[model samples]
Target: MLRYLFLTVTTLAIVGCSNEQPQALGTLEWDRINARAIASEAIVEIYAAEGDQLEKGQQILKLDTLLQQAKVAQLEANVSVAQWQLEKLRAGYRTERVTAAEAALNAATSDRVTKDRTYQRQLELRAKNLNSQNDVDSADNRYQSSVANEKKASEELHALRAGYRTEEIEQAQAQLTAADAALRYGKLLLSRYIVTAERAGRLDSLPFKLGDKPPTSAIISTLLAGDTPWARVYLPEPWLSQVAIGDEVSIKIDGRETTLNGRIRYIASQASFTPYYAMAEDNRARLSYIAEIDLLDSDAQTLPVGIPLQMVKP
Candidate 1:
């Protein structure tokens, strides 16, 4: 009979052991979230309104560049001129230009020769008493004038053959460089006028309108990055020891439980003031340590930021 009583007790004990439950040390409720505003070098011309969904690299603002556009046009024209100059310098003057200059030089040379002959004839006539001294002097002046004309024409021909001067090419090249930079600056300014979504996310505000000047360093707009959103949890001093980095925890939201892989990414070494909204029902003005629970890829987008959560602390 004693053996039967012992067997019955053993069976009941085994049943009780089978029904035993696991206990959680504590729980972390709610995720803390803050708004992140977009910033850039461009003037914020909002193409999309507050709450507008945006894709990455979409242009939302533009800067004024009429002056720069004109500058670009002027530079293009100068480039054509520079190209012509470079080509002319490399190939020498065109055949037609050189031919015309050569013709002028030849005409001048012929005139000089004819005048010299006339002067010589006049002098001989004077010596033979067949011409006046005034006539000889006039022929001599005419010959001198023709000689000067020939020299001038020869110099012009040489200049034409030289193409553009070294200094002129250098100056044009400099202008081209400056004009390029100016156009780039204008385009940059145009970029400044327009703002774009740097990352794919939700736009939160349009504080500054299309023409309104937004205060520098002030919140013009906000964006909440969709992918990789994390739930920040504040663990109490007593419960923190149970939760460490890389510990798996179970989180329940709206009665649906999901395993949130917690990476002890951030542990506030020093305790900070508890976020006002994080006021626990049992604790007031609690000094708490902050930790981040990374959401799983499937639940990342659906996880509500600052949602009151129940984390079954291990």
Candidate 2:
């Protein structure tokens, strides 16, 4: 009878131990996001403070934009000038200029005719021994000069009538397009001077205060992203095969009586151990796989991060 009682007690204790669920220890955490400065400009205004709940696209801070705005204005002026130049090219030469060219051509032709007549008269006189060789040479030179002037004027008139060349017009258009693109880029850079929140979350920190100049690409703000916190737990090798992503689990906070509901969201492919080369059976048991469990309850959103918790497998 004494032996049977001892056996029965041993059986009950073993059964109770087997019924206890396996638990993994972890801490509550939130996804962190950083907002960086696009330029090394002084912070002029702060729209949101640390710990403030922020909405997506909400203004977080403003950097000094005076210089950027001036640059944009200069680009705008260049765009305008380019536009005018393109318009001028497309319109071709003005009517008044064409008329002037025509008039110049006619005047040059009249002068050339007059000089030719004088040269012919001088040559005839020289042939009759009435004029010296020097006189004939001077008249010949004047006639040649007038002929060159007439040819130049005629070409100028023809160019005016033909208007701008196709290549010239295309070059002007390309310049305008380039200017417009530059202006658009300047405006985009100007917009970056005002920093805004990229996601809806609680503002965790503001590294720069008002009037503080932050270097380019420096983190200006930090946010704890997501509505609810997640549990960062390590799954022992023994339970690695039992749990998977999307599996439901129970979460017990260290100081809370009520348990929270969660679902496994991620599990590391590699196991984490102090010494990677340890292949002994005892060392293999020490390997733990990193995993993340997302809280499903709305109240979990208000929970503070870094609080100890236990994830109990269901």
The CA lDDT of each predicted structure is 0.64, 0.88
Return model 2's CA RMSD, one decimal.
7.5
Candidate 1 lDDT tens digits, 109-170: 99999999999999999999998999999999999999999999999999988877888767
**Alpha-carbon deviation at 71 in model 1, angstroms:** 7.9
lDDT for residue 43 in candidate 2, whole number 0-100: 97
TM-score of 1: 0.51
Clashing pairs in 2: none
Over the stretch 175-201, how does candidate 2's per-residue lDDT look in tens digits? 999999999999999998888888999
Off by over 4 Å in 2: 1-24, 119-145, 271-288
* Per-candidate TM-score against the hidden true structure: 0.51, 0.75
TM-score of 2: 0.75
